[model samples]
Target: MSKLGQIGAKLHRGEVSYDFIGHRKLWFGISIALVVISLGGLFARGLALGIEFKGGVEYEAKVKVTDSTVQDFGDAVKATNAKDLGDPVVTTINDEKVRVQTKPLAQADIGTVRAAIAKEAGIPAEQVTSQQIGASWGQQIADKAILALIVFLVLVFGVIWVYFREAKASMAAIIALVHDVTITVGVYALIGFDVTPATVIGVLTILGYSLYDTVVVFDKVRENTRGITGSNRYTYSDATNLAVNQTVVRSINTTVTALLPVGAILVVGTVVLGTGPLKDLSLALFVGIAVGAYSSIFIAPSLLAVFKEREPGMQALNKRVTAKKAQLAAAAAAPVGVATVGAPAGAAARSDVQDTPRKADRATGAAPAPSSRPMKAAAAGRPQPTRKPRSKRGK
Candidate 1:
């Protein structure tokens, strides 16, 4: 088998595992550091809101081959001879289209800027197209985006809680979801990416995908741990670790398959197509999905384990599992043919409710108690009485 296949098989069979739940402190520390850094970037640097959100006037002009360039356009806009034009944002599209953005402007000012760009690009005045945008529309859009996010989170919380029947699992999944988004937005803020409607859409889309990935891991955990308290073979955390290991390869595969296309779009949009919605959308998706995969594997399960371990029942169960494992280890280390003594049956029963041989049978070498039903003579190993053939004759 291939190396990856072998590793996957080991993981599936619980032969190989990563103790995500056991080393939760380290994982929590890392997540805390990342979240702090992200929040810091968000508040300190802030995001560069796009024209759709900030409400700015934009102008696009087409220019034929001439002795003009972006630098010449910048100089022209700088010397626009119009008051309060402020700083202009300029981008070149396909080396033929020049797009310029500036703060809201009066009609006369717009005309001035258009005329300036046209003259600078050596293009006809009619080739310049100008549009005025209102801040109210942007405000409405921002409100709607926030509302949509809140609703999405609410629905996701309800769904996860209901499906898992465990609030801690749901909480962990939601926290991981938040981690993915916060890091994605923080990267955008740190790099000063324009926060556009497309970016918002990408963020929302990734939330669902992130939740889906986390749910997959959590579902495995639920499956592995069903009726876990019935035996001491494994603790809840051990079951969770096995679940994560079993699904780690699957998560990596899914993330890689999904990311390849987004990475392509990001590269192509930023490199080949220049600045556009594709760049904005793909950048958000790439960051969000990558972080989502990471949190699903490393963060969510660990946090869930931590939360579960805090419960009184789980804590006691874990203690019993630990003690049982220690006992088994000691028994194995003893010399060959050495009988290791264990705690009394009553104590073991009170601790784990596991089946143990009756103390009386062990002491006296007597058979165990019989079942409620009467056994047949042959089955019970008792010889059958010789049938009295004369009984029929006597009757």
Candidate 2:
């Protein structure tokens, strides 16, 4: 088998694993740093909202053969030097059409802007079309999106908590989901990606995905830890680690499969179609899905273990597990079958029996008592039965 295949098999069987829970503080610090940077970017640069949200005027016109190129359209529009108007964004639609968008303008200034664009493009003034947008409509949409996000979060929290029957697991999953979103949005704010309605939908869609991945890991953890307290073989944290290790391959496979299509959409939409809703939606999904898978593997279970280990019951259980582990290690390291010189034969025999594993002893609440009779009968041949011939006559 390939090296990777062997590694995956080992991980699945819990024979090999990384100490994610043991090093959780480091992961926590890294996440905090990233979040802080993202927040800084958000406040410093802010997101570049699309015209639909900010309310702007749009003008589209077909350029004449003798017209200046689309590059000169922005300069020509700015040459009008109208007051209180933001810069115009000029883009080419195909080879013949140029589109110009700008902040909201007064009714009279719209005609002036349109005429300037037409003149620069060497097109008839009537060829340029203009439309005014109101900010109130955009505000309403923004409010509704926020409301939807809140409702979604509330519902996700309830569903996860109910399914897991553990508040810490739900809380960890929620935190991971929030982490995915915060970073995704931060990327938007930092890179100045346009926040369109499609972007909002992408953000909401990722929440469910992040939750799904986290829940899968938590479910495995729950299964591994069932009846775990009855013995000292493993602690809750160890069980959690095993669960994560077992599911790592599955998570990686799922994320890769999901990301392939998203990556294609992002590339095709951005490169071929240029900036549009498709690019916006795909970019958000790509970031969110990647981060979600990462958190499910490294962050969620670690947090769950951390939260659980703090309880008194878990602490005692872990203590017992640790003590048992130490004993086993010492036993493995010690020299075997080296009876003490001058010790009584019976004492040595009893010592050997005592050193045996205590699993059956613990379960049955007693050690095996020494037997007086031979384990096998002294004679190898079967015992002969004595028959009374007189019994037939009596019958």
Candidate 3:
């Protein structure tokens, strides 16, 4: 690979990651500011709720229409005398054909709506095509979308729990997904895209992409950790580093390929053509896809590393490894702490737990019985000195 590519791989893998948690205070202000700014965007502007949620009529028609010259569809809807007629949306479906869509219409006005489309396009009422879906259709779609999101979250959580068999991995991925989804929604509100059924569909698509990217990195870590014995070369951190290195480029490539067409639609529909379905759908996808990629690579993987490092067992492992390495060097230099240390090296170093009495120690391997002291005092007190028997002390 090129030097830039190699450098990027290392950067994602924490080859350059500093003690970010140790410096959490440094980022705390930034994090809070971002969240507050995002919330203000959400609260002040509010979402542009689509016709589906607000209850609107949807019309689908195969107009015997060509792009060359046709009367304005908007003017036709205006002539229909339909109550609350929104701007009629238009686009081409295939060769020499077009589709005219509009917001929901009242149930009583369907016939007048029919007559309007016929008159506007200069076609016979029968020859011009149409179907009307009620505004309540939005609720059904919303319910299904909510159900799908919940189900997806549950499955992803369970699968991560099983795959990594590590709580840290699951939490890291879930939190990052939250970041992605929320940021996308926040952007939607800020930019004011109409929240259509297409938006819900876009968000769902983002969920799958986000989860897949997270799992790919996690899987790489798991595979790389076969014998991650606390060596200088191999640790939980190293496995994580390798995982990120392997996946960052792939994630970027996947996100770029998916967004290319969406990007095109965004540019053309908004700027050049001045209209299309890209408004309702592609906007959310564009934002969600970009955020999903970022969170999966940077936020999710970094959080996983941070979380696992905080785990007591993992901390203990690092302590043992460090202690062992130090003790080995000490043994070579002085040879006393080495001889005094136990066979298992770090096992017998229980500074917090008291030793068993001689009789109890000999009777069984378990620790000594408690002195019937109250729990609070015993735990609260400093270690008390105990006298040894005369015979054993001399020996």
Candidate 4:
């Protein structure tokens, strides 16, 4: 096998493992910090809703774009000062076109704004085009997006609960999902990315992707923890940790594979094309996929372990496992074959005969002889018996 395959095998067999469960506090702390920062960004620098989400008028002008093109066009639109025309958002596309967005305006005001932008671009008024979006339509889209998110979350919860038959796993999966969404959204808000209908679609798509990774880990957890209460070899946390390790490599591979194309799209949309639905969608997907992979490996399994370890059965199992380990340690520390000082000679000799073969059996992993005979120890300094030479008569 290749080196990575060998490592994966070792992880599956519990030969190589990371204590994701044991170090959950650290992970939780980091997640909390990131979430706090995200929340802060959302409150301080709100999302830049696209014209699809908030009703607005858009004007496109074919012009020789320059470093100051966006600023120059934005100034021209503001100069028109048409009724209800709020601040215009100006951006460049392909270094050839300038696009401006503003609050919905009257028909006469729309022409004036379009003419102003055209004049600034040194193009004919006919060359500049305009489109108006209504506030009611935007509101409907927002409501539907919210409704879709709710339905998706409800279905995810129901499916996981039914499949795992464990409320803790379901809850953990949801928390991880929320973590992925929150981080992705927060990144968008912080970066001032436009939240369009395509962005909403991207967000919904990533929820499924995130859930998929979480479910895989949870399935492994369920498999590892089955009938665990009857065994003293591992606690619930240990099993969960093993499950995380077994699936970590797979999650990394899947996330990397998914991100490559999404990353390309994001670069093309933002750097080459200069803003479109593709950019918006790819940004959400890229952030969500990475964060989902992280939450699956760290957040979901660790939280499940925390919840499971709190149960009475798991607590009892942990105690039993701990006690068993202590007993083995004590036994290993005690001197073997040492008789009590007050013991009788016969008793001491019998103990030696019994213990010697048992120790030998343990060391060699071989079964003891079936004969009910005690092994005799050779006396110190006694001459060893030698085998007699075979006669040549048979030849």
Candidate 5:
């Protein structure tokens, strides 16, 4: 184990026993549950689209209104007869102009809204460059964004598969990325945050970041697995575990560093500057960074182990290694007095018990000891066997 791997091992308790991707299954199941919950939230509460998609009236006015900030502009729009101003977007694009984007108003309602904004900022309607977008553009923008999302997924999975050369590995990594995205998006939907063009951009950025983290760990696994294709020294799961442990700390550090700026945006943009694209984009990044970090570590690599080991040959490899170890152990524990049961060259072997030998006397040649005891007397000393039972009658 590397130093980092050692630290992670100390930090996390390893699996007590092998279960053939059982731990990975836990990760997969949880990931699926999160996706389902997120999709449900998406269905329950619709996305909050900005003026760019909602086809609302937008105003870009460089009015030098004293003591009137973007919030003042929004308040001015809402306070006057255009009270139904539908969340005016105010941005300090530069020193002189505060670009305001807002929802579209009716032809009759347009004049009143303009007059109210002008009065609040104390600028004439001529100073405001206002444009109206029809609601039809929302559907188009949504369609295009969906198309782009699909295209992105295909490209991402393709790149991973080509780079890894293992379909299961690529698939596992992609699923983890999707899991992170779903979690982030679900939170956004539940929180009712605005889904603007900027939000879409942020989502793409996060996807790239998540993939980078996964690729880093995957690269480590690939390096470890080199030249270890056949032997059991480094199983696929072993390489993956080491890889995850090695990069886990790095992933955590990267996420924390990226989150700092996003945290600032959430604070400064929303709390200090009020509602804007920065706020929406910040919200998305904040959610994505956390989920991306999680999926890269616990979700991705674990899934990789599970999927890579799922093949029939790989399964057989694990069983063979286990059986070999067991056989060696049993051989070592045999009793000390017991000998292995075998014969050489197909010759029958005998036990260690010996038989008494019969030999001729050296001095008197053969039969020299035949008269030591009379043969007849010696034979007579031997007990006779019992006679068989006689018939009931002598017939």
Candidate 6:
């Protein structure tokens, strides 16, 4: 087998493992810090909503490519200074067209603005096209996007709850989903990315991807923790840590696979195509996918382990496992050949045998009374049984 396959085998067999659940505090702390920073950026900088979200007038002027074209066009539109023109945003589309956007304007103002842009670009007024977008239409789109988001989250919770029959798992998944979305939005706000309809679509797509990855990890956790209450070999946290280790490679592989194409689109859109839907959509997808993968692997399972460990069954199991480990450790550390004179040879041996059944019973939720019967002593000089000679046996 290849190196990676061998490592995966070791993970599956619990030979090599990462303590994700055990060191959950570190993960949670990191997430909290990121969330705090994201929130700060969001409240401070806010999102740069596109014309589709906040209704505005858009004008596309065809002109020769020049470094000063954007500044000149922006100045020309602002020179109109018509009512409600506000600030004009001018961007180049593939160095061929200058796209200008401003707040909604009256028909006369739109004509004036278009005329100014056309004169500056040395083109006919009719050559510069203008489109008026209504605020009500933008509001409707926003409302529907929010409604879709709500429905998606509700369905996700229901599906996870029904599939796993575990509310904790569902809640953890939802929390991770929210974490991914919030961080994505915050990053957009911090970086002043245009929040367009394409951005919304990308956000929704990443939610599914995040949930899918979380569900994969959760499924492994469920399998690992099955019948866990009856076994003192692993606590809920141990099982969860093992589950994360078993699936971490697959998660990394999938995330890398998904991010490669997204990274390409983001590069091409931002560099080659300039500002457009591709840039908006690809930026959202790239950030969301990366953050989604992190939350699924680090946030979701760790939270689930925390919730599961709070259960009474898990608490008892953890105590038993802890106690059993301590006992084994002490036994192993005991000095050999320490039996004193007159001490029965079988004394320590009998004690171990007597404790075995009790530990087994406790592990399996059984209550067995300790045996009070004294152990029989071993003969001081007992002879060993000898095997018969092969020749004598044949004769």
Instruction: Estimate candidate 1's RMSD in Å.
Output: 11.4
TM-score of each model, paired residue for residue = 0.77, 0.76, 0.67, 0.77, 0.75, 0.79
RMSD of each candidate relative to the true structure:
11.4, 10.7, 17.2, 8.3, 14.4, 10.9
Q: lDDT of all predictions, in order shown? A: 0.83, 0.84, 0.69, 0.88, 0.74, 0.88
Candidate 4 least-lDDT 10 residues: 371-380
Per candidate, the number of residue pairs that clash is 0, 0, 3, 0, 4, 0
> Model 5, range 50-138, lDDT digits (tens) per residue?
87787888777666634348778887677655535676777776567776776767776777667766776677987777778877887
Clashing pairs in 1: none
The local distance difference test score of model 6 is 0.88
User: Comparing candidate 3 with candidate 5, which one achieves the higher TM-score?
Assistant: 5
lDDT of 2 at 344: 49
Cα displacement (Å) at residue 323, model 6: 1.4
Q: Of the candidates numbered 2 and 4, which has the greater TM-score value? A: 4
**lDDT tens digits by residue: candidate 6, 210-238:** 99999999999999999999888999988
For model 5, what is the C-alpha lDDT against the true structure?
0.74
Estimate, for each residue in 131-248, the C-alpha lDDT of model 2 and write its tens digit.
8767887788889988998888788888888888888887888888888889999999997778888999999988888888888899999999998888899899889989988888
CA deviation > 4 Å runs, candidate 1: 61-99, 119-127, 337-395
